[model samples]
Target: MNSHEGRPAGLRERTRRAVQAEIVATAMRLFLEHGFEATTMEQIANDVGISRRSLFRYFGTKEDIVLGDHAEHGLALRAALEARPADESPWEALRAALKSLFESLPYAPEEFIKITTMLHASPSLRARQLEKRQQWAELLMPDIAARLGEATDPMTRLRAHALVACALACSEAATDAWVHSNGTIDMERAYDEAVAAVRG
Candidate 1:
């Protein structure tokens, strides 16, 4: 038998995921209490009862800790877009994919608002947020190019980038409206209206 035969597959992945979640949770709490600039990796590691080196193994920087969940969201958004029915128009598929991705958020709307507020208040975080959106656009490009039946054309690539940019803009606008309303506005409705406006 092999040296490691019969072990459960993905056990290492599961453990890594668990540790990452713990680090994120701890870092978020510290950031909320002390502000992002004031928080340190050492403090986060100490709070989570791990060494700074161990923390670095999971995240490369403080910004990564703050925006870690966003990376997952980008991946999920790409998957949602890719899984959309081929018969659906690009605009419709984009709208449905955004809605589905938003609905799958593990946190409540209030928590999202808090995170948004934090991001807006921090220049570094806002930069990271834009970077994440750009990454999403990159992720969506190939799928969009295929969906539009112009997989190898330069115009198709530009169009795909424009569509993803528009979607990201709509999402930002909806988030701004929600924040301005103090969470009284329904996020789903706001996002839907924003997307529809873009489609028109």
Candidate 2:
């Protein structure tokens, strides 16, 4: 039974999500094991027990397997930021909004290192990651501006943009620290430390 709707998810939707999650998990393992560039869609499709044609139905390309969730995450962050109390500091609200990101992490800390390490090492993936960050910042900027009580001043918009950019940078730094330390570091604490230094 699904607590949100008080009923189970439809069989097809549940099955689809399960299959996609399996594909993502398996593909990450493969990408880490064999370099991402070296890994092929056919290989992922084979490993996931689906035909290559069917894999395309779930994810358009190899990169999508890695990044398909970013769009949902951007929307989630925007919604979370909008839900924060009006009096909350933008930084605090952003930090809280990021809880959705952390909560949606699909792998264990150790397994996450594989994904992050691969992304850190790949230029193509890094470029796509930056694009996704820019998209997220754009999505959250309006909510941030609202929280700042800034309506139309250009400077207000710029400040909101800066805050969103800085928050993302802080997140990246913390994730990098955690990955470099082989996940021994607490990511949220690392993020807090980065923010403290940035704010100081």
Candidate 3:
């Protein structure tokens, strides 16, 4: 049984969140200033006023800094999908999750544009991010398979994969559109449009 399940969660959870947020903040600053490849773990550690070993306690590698919370994002999406009305279609549930994500970000369009730029500018990071997305797909696949039950044959898995791929592709397209429009367009709208196109 999870300790957090029963009690009102306490200081440890708060501390963990604050520490993780600080790590991401510090790492993002370094990444933007020096470029991802040029930034070193030692520099990040020094900048954060910690030993290299200590930094590793928070993040094992530089790539991990960028992709660390990606798994958590998947989990959140799953939770969001689960919360949608039981009668909701999978695509509809996924659309709700996308909307929730777009709404949850605190950054301005310019900031998000820069993040997308940085991710693409670094080849290794891009590859790593893609790999992470694939890993997320695998994590999600089982749930989708179970949802489809006996109907979830190989062809069903293929369709489910395609749906997941389509969602991702829409997200990327929306980001590109957001960047190109210079904060003029609504990202949520772009995402909605992409999903609509894919569903159609």
Candidate 4:
């Protein structure tokens, strides 16, 4: 075996990740507390006790800090879709995957509501969010095409696009309903109703 193969666990990697997470968390809190445009990189760096240069090393731009690392999520979602039983229809697979996704939403509903509310009010962040979702749709389309067995066809691509769009629309509507209700109702129920509206 190569000498590097049996090396001790990488302490640097863990430390770097800890620092990065702290920076991102601080940025998010700042962004929520103050408007996105008002929260400067210097403020984030200061809050995290790091140099601005060090902060840039971890995230090139402020937007990257708030978005939290979605590149890995697409790969994981595709893998989940691929592992789904072959007999299931594309819609079925997508619905099941989405249910899992909704149930496992990373942040608390309150946090998501705050972040999304901020995003919705800000033009630059709104554009970035759209771009990120577009990238995710592009990443997912091919796998979906293969599963639906129309890899070479435009119609399949359209369907996949529509499906992702529909899902996002439903989730966003439900999120709005949840937020406007101010924690008085179960957000999961709102999400389910949104999905049902799409299904019907």
TM-score winner: 1
Cα shift from native, residue 36, model 2 (Å) = 1.5
The candidate 4 region of ten consecutive residues with least summed lDDT is 3-12
Overall lDDT per candidate, in order of appearance: 0.86, 0.89, 0.78, 0.76
Q: Please provide, for model 4 over 1-200, each residue's C-alpha lDDT reduced to its tens digit, 9 standing for 90 to 100.
A: 67775454576778888998888888988998888999999999999998999888999888888775765665666667677887777666766665666566678878877877888888888888778777767766776677767778889888878876776666668777877786677766776788787889
lDDT of 1 by residue, 1-200 (tens): 56566455568878899999999988888887788889999999999999999999999998898887787888999899989988888777877888888889877777877877888999999998899889888888888878878789999988888987887888889889998898999877897798888777
Sorted by TM-score (best first), the order is 1, 2, 4, 3
Predicted structure with the largest lDDT when compared to the true one = 2
The candidate 2 region of ten consecutive residues with least summed lDDT is 1-10
TM-score of each: 0.89, 0.86, 0.81, 0.82
The residue-by-residue lDDT of candidate 2 on 65-152, one tens digit each, is: 8999989989888888888898899999999989767877667888778888888888888999899989999999988888777647
Q: Residue 112 in candidate 1 has what lDDT?
A: 76
Candidate 1 vs 3: which has more lDDT: 1
By TM-score, is 1 or 2 better?
1
- Predicted structure 3: lDDT: 0.78
